[model samples]
Target: MVIRLAIVFVLTFVSCQEENDIAAKNILGIGRMQAVAVSGRLICNGRPATNVKLKLYENEILFDRLMEESRTDSNGQFRVSGSKREISRIDPKLNIYHKCNYNGLCYKKFTIKIPKDYINNGREADRTYDIGTLNLANQYPGQSTDCIN
Candidate 1:
């Protein structure tokens, strides 16, 4: 009877350890790294808009909060990362600051809405969502745009 009791205790300990391991992975994002990867090229007119400031924001009802930021490289390419928990709550947006003009109209800042489904939400391990190329141009007459900055 003592031997059977010992075996049962060991099995319980092992089961708890397994559960703790999974919980740790989920909380620390060990196996779920790279929850959201936003990468794209910033183009203004016909040339690469290099050295532009890019900011990531979570669009909420009351206000939009900035999460991460990155600058465009020499080729106007940028990449930014965010956690699943922060991005899953609200819609993500990419804000760009540049001096782009079209037909005598210029915009110093612009925003791009990121699709909600693009975020992994920690369900998939090592997932990356490519937002593709972002072509930023000045607004024409009667053209609607979202600018914050």
Candidate 2:
């Protein structure tokens, strides 16, 4: 009877009760998933943009599932969650999105290369990675190409 009670206690502690209102406001589950905080500059017209909407992408698709977005402050700097460190440390993935309207308007999405083992200095957490600066130009409108340098 003691052993049965102990096992039940352990199970209760480790389970994620999402459907059951599991810690309703809890940001992340106890399972193996990544956590990220992202910020950077979205250069509009070669300068820090104001109220520029940002988007994140994954698997060549962009939406609610694989993306998080934020606006750049007056400094033209912003951040977003990039990846999870503890669960998938080696596979760091970051895709920054931008949209500009000029000469018929153009929108583009670019991928930033981040290797595993890269640590974010700001977070001081080993599981986080940085996708540096993302600059967008309206030279070629609406060409959703993966920008890499």
Candidate 3:
């Protein structure tokens, strides 16, 4: 009877440990669900484009979901955040509405690709991506211009 009790106790202890492990993992996952920050600067006509509207969209097949929106500061800096899962999928893009002129005409709208590498793949506890400088005056020369409207 003592041997049987010892065996049962061992099994109970092991089961409890497993349950605790799973619970800990779930807690960690919940903690990671916080927003991932994205930051960058916008330069137009060789100067900071202040108050430019910037929007984050999750590119989807049927419809695009707007995740966050921000306006450039006086220094042309902006910061936005979204869930890591949403921002890391299907090639996220940034839509900028500004009056950046090109060839005597103001290109009022533009889109820029946010590289997948800029998003954390759920491997880091804290994630923030800096997309560097985006120049509205020039759309990187021969890049896809269809995003301009």
Candidate 4:
């Protein structure tokens, strides 16, 4: 009788713990996100030709999903971030670019979403997140190129 009672108590405690965990994690589903946009001369007709207004796209939807937007600096640089909670789910775009070479001239948008399981797995995920940079095709050079610097 004592053994059965103890088992029941243990099970009850575990179930309650699981319930608590679920409750705690539910509040942060979106995940925190941030991004930087940049534009530069890429051997355009030998000399740099000022690219016109180019709209950068992330997640391939439209010009609305971006959490933040910035005009390119004098050197053509921009960064956007969509803040969301960091949990077991997929996070928002880290960086967004509008007008790869120029702005408002048939703008092309790009989004970068990374596989962030670190919140749940911890250290193990760091290796992947650090080993390289996450590259999404929509960027200026597309997926064919990779940069982690």
Strongest candidate by lDDT: 3
Worst 10 residues of 3 by lDDT: 140-149
What is the per-residue lDDT of model 4 for residues 35-133, given as tens digits with 9 covering 90 to 100? 323233222233322322223233422222333444434433333223322333434343433333343434344434444442232212222232122
Q: Which residue pairs in candidate 3 have backbone atoms (N, alpha carbon, C) closer than 3 angstroms, thus clashing? A: none
For model 1, which pairs clash? Answer: none
Q: Compose the digit string of candidate 3's lDDT tens values, residues 35-109.
A: 345688999878998998878776755555566788999999998765433322435677777767744344366
Can you give the TM-score per candidate against the true fold? 0.57, 0.47, 0.57, 0.30
The lDDT for every candidate, in the order shown, is 0.64, 0.48, 0.65, 0.35
Model 1 segments more than 4 A misplaced: 1-34, 84-88, 102-107, 123-126, 138-148
For each of the candidates, the C-alpha root-mean-square deviation to the true structure, in angstroms, is 13.3, 9.8, 14.1, 13.7
lDDT of 2 by residue, 1-149 (tens): 99999999877754634344224323464324444454556676677766655554323222223435666788677765543223223233445445544332443555554453553433233553444444566433334644431
Stretches of candidate 2 exceeding 4 Å from the true structure: 1-31, 57-64, 82-92, 100-106, 118-134, 138-149
What range of 10 consecutive residues in model 1 has the weakest lDDT sum?
A: 140-149
Error of 3 at 123 (Å): 13
Selected candidate, larger lDDT, 3 vs 4: 3
Regions of model 3 farther than 4 Å from truth:
1-35, 84-90, 102-107, 121-125, 140-149
On the 0 to 100 scale, the lDDT of residue 19 in model 2 is: 42
Candidate 2 weakest lDDT stretch, 10 residues: 57-66
Q: Write the per-residue lDDT of candidate 1 for residues 126-148, one digit (tens) a residue.
A: 44456666667745334343354
Q: Which sequence of candidate numbers ranks them by TM-score, best first?
A: 1, 3, 2, 4
